[model samples]
Target: MTNPPYGTAPGGQWPPAGSPFTSPAAGPVSSQKQSRGPVIVSLIVAVLAIAVAIGAWFRTAHSDVTTQSTTAPQQFTTQQTSDANKALCDSYHKMFRSVNGAGGQTSDDPVLQQVYAINIRLATHVASDFMYDKLRENPAGSPQLASDLRDLANAYNEVLMAQLADAPKTELDPLYSNIDSADAKLVEACK
Candidate 1:
């Protein structure tokens, strides 16, 4: 075959009039939209961090009022609980008998009303301080006994309050019956 012409190949021109080392001219662009996504994300993260820090500060600041009880409430043997029940019940029993014996029919009798209040105060003192207090310090072993004793103590206190308010003779029997029922429950629970 015959030799080809200068700066030309068999079917095309050579190099195409461009340098390989030169970069292409850049196109005009709008100023980069300050990506709002990152700014929003950063603000959200900051707010959440502040919220967590504030919650922790509040929890610590109020810790004194929320102080945990270190003392463990304790339970007792059946016999011990039974004894406690008996003590409270005995006070109620005595109060019932004494108030009944005081026996004033008229609600307007100031001396008798005063006597009722004094006896009620005494009975409340006995039940609350002597027996109920101990039971609270050491809970009953059996759930039934504990419930029964609580009922009795509450009933005893309620009766005392009623008597102090000079509940009528008509109200006396039912109040006494409540005490007896609670006491019987205590007896049955211990058994």
Candidate 2:
């Protein structure tokens, strides 16, 4: 007998390329399709794993941003100009009390010295206010007064500059001299 050309030889067991093979234990052709079920399940599991990873990344990023925003430091500022004024007034009273309590000793002691130093600063502060008011009230009232105000301002700046750290007392002597000069000029302008 001649074998069919498309499927398999009639006397032999080898199957043709187009013929489907069957296993002895498998019941039907549909059972082979069930083998692909595990592959589908693996694909589904991989996709779910990727989704969980993406969700975790977003949660961590959001938490990090929230912590950073909440932990920012706040700025500190004095509420009013009156605070500086009050500090100035209190400093003056403190100096007065210290000097008055010093029975017989000169004010060249450390406590009194600090008081003197800070008083000069206070004087400079008051003079600044006076000079500003003077300039604002009379822009071109008197040349001599204007010159005196300028001198006063320069002298105050010099004195304040002398109080800097690492500056020698000899350096500050000029500032004191300048202050005296300004005081004399102011007195002359008044007269």
The residue-level lDDT of candidate 2 at 19 comes to: 43
lDDT of 2 at 58: 50
Residue lDDT tens for model 1, 15-106: 33454532333322334646655565566556655765675465433222113222454565779767766654554456446545544334
Candidate 2 lDDT, tens digit per residue, 41-133? Answer: 466556655765675465323233224325653342444333433433333344334433442344755555544444554445445444444
TM-score of each: 0.39, 0.39
Runs in model 1 lying further than 4 Å from the true structure:
1-121
- Report the Cα lDDT for residue 54, model 2: 74
Off by over 4 Å in 2: 1-116
**All candidates: CA RMSD in angstroms?**
28.7, 31.4
* Residue 32 in candidate 1, Cα distance off native in Å: 99
TM-score of 2: 0.39
Each model's number of backbone clashes? 0, 0
